[model samples]
Target: MTGRQVIVRRARAEDIPGLVASSAGLFAEDGGTRDSSVNVDWPREHGARSFAAALDDPARLVLAVEHDGQVVGHLMGSLTGPTAKRPVTSATLVSIHVRPGHRRARAGDRLVEEFLDWARRQGAEHAEVTAYSANTDAVRFYERSGFAAMTVTLRQPL
Candidate 1:
């Protein structure tokens, strides 16, 4: 904890750098460690364009968590509209990460709450997120945030 108030808000154009940094950190610390094929450098190389496009899309939400005036965390979410076969609006919590020092400080809770609020506003009846099955901490966090395990995804190496 930096002893400074943490603020979570929608990301703006100027926060792209911070968003990219946080995303890269997530890939390095989480994906790189848990998955064999994660490209840790992708965020540094292509995040700016992706995040910029996300910022401009109404169906997406990008949030930044700042502590001591520095971006230490971020969350990205998207809404999917009703389809011909599945006529339900759904929201997906695409990704979220907070610096180690910023964890246990309610920053993640704030991000999830804001995203849920936005989804509700958009008439989303359900929300979902996918976490690595081995990451128990994240599974617990999402469970505490009102998410339940709805299905399992398994993979076998070739």
Candidate 2:
């Protein structure tokens, strides 16, 4: 691994385009594009608006990880809570995506840490994330980041 420096920070409005690019990289992985029932082309106009909205929303966090002034990674997180089963507030790591070349540079860890800090400030008592069960690499990554499997999601192809 190269000793390159990476910066993780809150996403700015202008960062939408870069963030969307990373989002496309994410969707292309793990069949996200194929599995979607809706017709949504990521890194496009709609996605730009969505990222901008996320930046403005107080309840949501969008982070961008930059390497040498270029956005190579992004993460989205939000606070969820007060379900009938769980009364305590929790933070969900909505999604995270890093460019293929930037994995293992502690960028993912930094992203999670920042999100957790945000959740704690929002009075969240627990943290959670969901990953595709079939993606063993993702599962291991989350596990290393201190997440354990809490639910099993099963799907049927009709």
Q: Taking the tens digit of each residue's C-alpha lDDT, what string does model 1 give over 65-120?
A: 98877888999999997999779999999989998888878899899999999999
lDDT, candidate 2, residue 155? 83
Q: After superposition, how far is residue 55 of candidate 2 from its true place, in Å?
A: 0.8
- Backbone clashes for every candidate come to 0, 0
What is candidate 2's lDDT per residue for 1-158, written digit by digit as tens? 44267788999987778898988778777546446663446456477888888888888999998888899999999887778998988999988998888877888888998998999999999899987777888889889888898889888978
lDDT of every predicted structure (CA atoms) = 0.93, 0.84
Candidate 1 stretches greater than 4 Å from native? 2-4
